[model samples]
Target chain A: MKIKKRLGLILANTILIIASLSVLLPILWVIRTSIANRLIAYKIPPVWIFTPTLDNFRMIFETYPFQDYFLNSLIISTAASLVALLIGSLAAYSIARFRTGDPALRLSMLSTQMLPPIALVIPIFLIMNVIKLWDSMTGLVLAYLSFNLPYTVWILISFFQGIPVEMEEAAMIDGCSRFQSLIRIVFPVALPGLLSAGVYNFILNWNEFLFALILTGRNTRTLPVAISSLWTQQGVNIGAVSAATVITILPVILLTFVIQKFLVRNLTFGSVK
Target chain B: MAKSSFFSNLPKHDQQTARNLVVPAMLGIWVVVLFPLLYALYVSVHDWILSQGGIGSFNFSNYFTVLKDPLLLNSAKNTVVLTISVVVLEILIGFGLALLLNNKGIRLRNIYLFILLIPMLMPPITVGLIWRLLLHPELGIINYVLSVIGLPQPLWLATPNLAMLTIIIVDVWHETAFIILVLLAGLTSMPEEIYEAAIIDGASSRQKFQFITLPLMAPTILVATIIRMIAALKTYDLVYILTRGGPGISTETISYYIYKVFFVALDVGKSSAMAFLLLLVIILMTFLLMKVMQKTEQNY
Candidate 1:
């Protein structure tokens, strides 16, 4: 019985080790490739070790306008997500507390989440052009609002629903107005929900590529759009591209770990809970 | 309508508050999404290629143009195949991993979970880049490692047969973590008493899993499948960054095809029609998902 139990333990540990390595190894290789010499990139035998260089990173900054793109991504993602969360939370509160909007409102809002972005892009592209917002950061923000606002509203609605309505009423009875009660009492109660929802929206906004690809100019390109623009060279700038890839995703990786705890709960939301 | 308006009048303050709160969000949606969607329908009927010139009177020919195109059919077939393959593999592998790690006595639990989630957390563009670098025909780390192990190393994205398979595998690697998390949550939250009872009855581990675990996990499985299917159907960043509709369009899913038609082929009208079709398909999927969720809620 002792031997059998030991064997089972060993088997489980082995599978666990293999699974962890498989997930980590490819990702680790990206870090490896980014730091390696550019010439060693296409060698038949992969170089396990080499002198690391910051040349690729430097090149992206010095030789290309990559910093503009980086700044654009940071600003656009932060701004758009904030605006979406602001309006979405208001809408969510109204829905949760007062049962506002037409009966079809919630479904209609959610249906926006389901719309293929490609369909939306055509008219959006035209509208932005006519309004002189084309190839600008504002245009990208508006495009992002379509997905972010509805998603934020929906997620926040569920979160707001979890709070008891009587808490706000109790604050009201103590001399707070409806709006004052929301600010003093309800906001604090629902702060975590707002935060998790905001973080999720930020991540989504940061990761969005296609609209940024279509809408941004050379001056206003975001990270994902910048990654696409890397492919113009013929000989495969693998090292440089890998370096840019790391730069682009490094912030998200940091943010993801911060997000890890709230992720599964918020992602599966009402259904899983 | 009259009765509802009168009722609205009685709760005048509440109604004012509700409208104030909801209007910004509704306006955002109206300006960005609803209006564009309606305009897209308008554009779909006109021959507004690039929305400049070639503009003609409204007609239904663009729908026909999109439908009759052999490429759209090819891409649709590829999207279906890819979606089915990826979702199935995700469910199997995700559930298997969840079972493996669901043990209470596991070592380095948080570390393992964190590492597993790295692929899912990174941007899809970044995911695409890493895989593209690793799948490079001559010098990729994967091919080198495969050669060391005496395994076959066919040129991955460069070859037609391997391209689609490669895309699916990369997608699986990225998304399987989500399913695993969902399933693991389901697994851990499952009532422990039933398993204890089974053990008390002298049932085998396999028996306990089959009789008790699988049935309970069915709802989670359904949830994961529905979400993954919708996500898989809308795959774009990976297709764009990695394959770019290359190696004879083997990796060109519907989203990629839409980009190709509208941006590359410069046929705005036809692309919009296909886009609308995709919208209908998504709504149909969500409708199915809601039905499934409702059914499972009743059963479980």
Candidate 2:
């Protein structure tokens, strides 16, 4: 029995070690390739060690205008998420506090999140073209609201519901208007929820591809779109593409880890928590 | 009607405040999501082609055409296969890992978990690109390593069958982290006293899992399954970046196919109809899954 137990422990560790390595090896390979020189990046019987250089990064920024694309991703992600959070929190507060749409309203809001983007993008593309907003920053930001608004509202509704009404009521009793109480009392209390929801939405937007792919022009392409375009242009520039991939994903990885603890709660939409 | 009924239950002053608060979000949804869907429905039924100039005629032929299209059929098949394959593999692998991680004897569990989850939120495009580089036939490290071990180095993204498998592998790599995260959370949050009671009852490990863990975890697993299925059904970016639904369309998904119909063929009406059809499949699947979940819960 003791031998059997020891064997089981060994087996478990072996499986975990394999799983962890599989996940880490590819990411580490990409990072290594990203910093390698052109020849070393794609060398057959790949180089085991080499001095890292920033030429690939410089190439992406100087030759490809990745800075603009990065800025575009930042701006669009921030704008869409902030807008969604601002209005979504209000609606969620109402729904939670007053039962503002009750069963139907709340259900409908969530169901909207399930609407496939392909379904929505069709009309959106046509409408944007008709209105001469195609490939514009405003058009993509507005389009993102289709998912972000509903998501923020749904997630925030749960958060708002978790807060007690007595806090807001006390503020109201202390000569605070409904709005003031919300601003002073409820907002501070729900700050974590708001931040998590906002960050989650921003990440979604930042990594969004299809809508941005179809909607943006040269001047407004987000990082994902920009990175994809790098792949299709001319011959395969493995070094440059590696650098671009690193650039596109590095911030997202950092942000994801920053919010790692809240991820389960956020991803499950507060269901498990 | 539901709104009015809900509003009537609130005090008069509160009703005004609620309406004011909810309207902006409602309007945002309407403008961005609801309005576009309604418009797509309208467009789907009309003979509208962008290059052909405006909504020409009202007809149901677009739906008929989209339904009859062989490519759409092929894409639907691919999507079903991809969705089922990825969800099943991810769940099985994720559940296994989560159980191992949840084991009381495991050390360095948190460190292993953090490493495992690094790909959870990386952009799918980058995931695709990274794999694409790693899988490059001549230059990639994968082939190099394979050659070192005296194994065959297959063209991962070039052959039709291999291309589909490659995409599936990449997706499993990218998305299994989410399943692990969810299931692990469920496993850890389970009541510990129940297990203690099971131990007192002289339950073997297998029996304990089958009798206690499986039944209790049904709901959380179902929730994870539903969310993954929904997302898998709409997969687009990975296919776009990795294969472009190429090697003779072996990996084409419904969304990728619709994208081609709309952008490449410029067939707006037909593509819209296809998109709606995809939406219908998703909604029906979700409904069916929820029904199954309800039945399972009742049994427990």
On lDDT, the candidate that comes out on top is 2
Query: Ten residues in a row with the worst lDDT in model 1 chain A?
Result: A101-110
* TM-score result, candidate 2: 0.97
Each candidate structure's TM-score, on Cα atoms with residue i matched to residue i, is 0.94, 0.97
Q: After TM-score superposition, what is the CA distance of residue A144 in candidate 1 from its true location, in Å?
A: 0.4
What docking tier does model 1 reach? Answer: medium
lDDT of each: 0.83, 0.89
| Stretches of model 1 off by over 4 angstroms after superposition | B1-10, B51-54, B295-300
Error of 2 at B149 (Å): 1.2
* lDDT of candidate 1 over B151-170, digit per residue (tens): 99998888997888999999
The numbered model that scores best in TM-score is 2
